[model samples]
Target: MELACAFLARNRMEEYELLRVFFDSKVVREGLSELQIPSPLGRDVGGFQEQWAGPLCLDGILAGLIVNGGAYKRYRGPARDAKVLAGAAVEALTQNRFEDFRVDVSHVAWAPWFANVAWDHTYILTDTANAEITVLCITDTD
Candidate 1:
């Protein structure tokens, strides 16, 4: 619901495309970089940390300040609220199909790898419980 809306809203505002995707739980065993997200991410691996969910919980890399940083502003990215985007991302990563949109992510454990800078908004997020993965990326070469 909201996750789908966030992607749609953001894509409309920017010239660059926002790569958004949801993957099956089985993809986790292949690792973050192998998830088939179509972006020119760095080749290095093992950058992810085991902690509370990043995109879902709206903490760590997905914090409001970082999500709304200069890169997003400079790129004229989504005009949507940061929290709404983050909440939608959580739904994507965890495969939580709640009708209400935002889910309680407080206890959700996630290990996420940020393929690029936080401000660039590129990441590979994994749900520890189901091992499902989701990716969100926006790139501009100007």
Candidate 2:
């Protein structure tokens, strides 16, 4: 439910035509990218720490991030590049706070990956800052 809403919320915001391809639940497929262990650490700078989840869809962004992630094979060129790029827009939308919506927005942890996900006003980022990641999970929403 949370993942679905995250993607839907972004789609509503971007208002792009190609994004419509992801709109249909029937066409949606379960997709998950496994963690690639031994990744270069991201700097928290000043002991940064957080976890945000609930009604957030960071799938598109995540897919692209992992697809191009240096730990794996570089996605070739334009065509594949375009697909990966789509994740960015969705990611941007996830970066906002629903607490400010002034309307009801309910989302839950559901089945967590690594049993954790980060949520703020924008996207749900799984923390890999301190450890190894071998898989990332994406799935068809319920």
Candidate 3:
């Protein structure tokens, strides 16, 4: 896996640390490159801002989508692709019914850092239903 770390939201430090433990584990590290944790979007009951990260694939087949306001430009993809993934992430956060869901972005080939061959994109989303935390992952495949 790449030794790079993406920028995380300062206000969400505690939540980011918890997520870091999971993303940095041996199991998750096997296939993921980098993990990004997004900041809170706005104020609403049960309407917490979406939290997401770009998880680069170890094989260089999956590039991560950059979260808005993130400071890590080195790990960001094209603006168009980023926007699309961001939109999908937001949708996942709003329309999620189950505790976990997957958003498909196979049509997007650009990695957060650079262009790569077309590969299946599956963003794994876990909703804690606490309105305070949500987990997201962008991978090469489901």
| Maximum-lDDT candidate | 1
- Tens digits of lDDT, candidate 3, 78-127: 76675566556565464634433222223333224223333323443433
State each model's CA lDDT, in order. Answer: 0.38, 0.31, 0.35
- The backbone clash count of each candidate, in order, is 0, 22, 3
lDDT of 2 by residue, 1-142 (tens): 3443454345342233222232222323243222221122222211222224332434444455445544335556654554546555434433344232211111223233322332211223321222111112333222
**Model 1 misplacement above 4 A:** 1-46, 52-56, 59-80, 95-122, 138-142
Cα RMSDs of all predictions? Answer: 13.6, 16.1, 14.6
Tell me which of candidates 1 and 2 scores higher on TM-score: 1
Using TM-score, rank the candidates from best to worst: 1, 3, 2
Please give the ranking of all candidate structures by lDDT, highest first, separated by commas.
1, 3, 2
Best by TM-score: 1
lDDT of 1 by residue, 16-92 (tens): 22122232223433555533533433322223322343343443335454454654353245535555665665655
> What C-alpha lDDT does candidate 3 achieve relative to the native structure?
0.35
The positional error of residue 78 in candidate 2, measured at the CA in angstroms, is 3.6
Stretches of candidate 3 exceeding 4 Å from the true structure: 1-16, 34-89, 93-126, 130-142
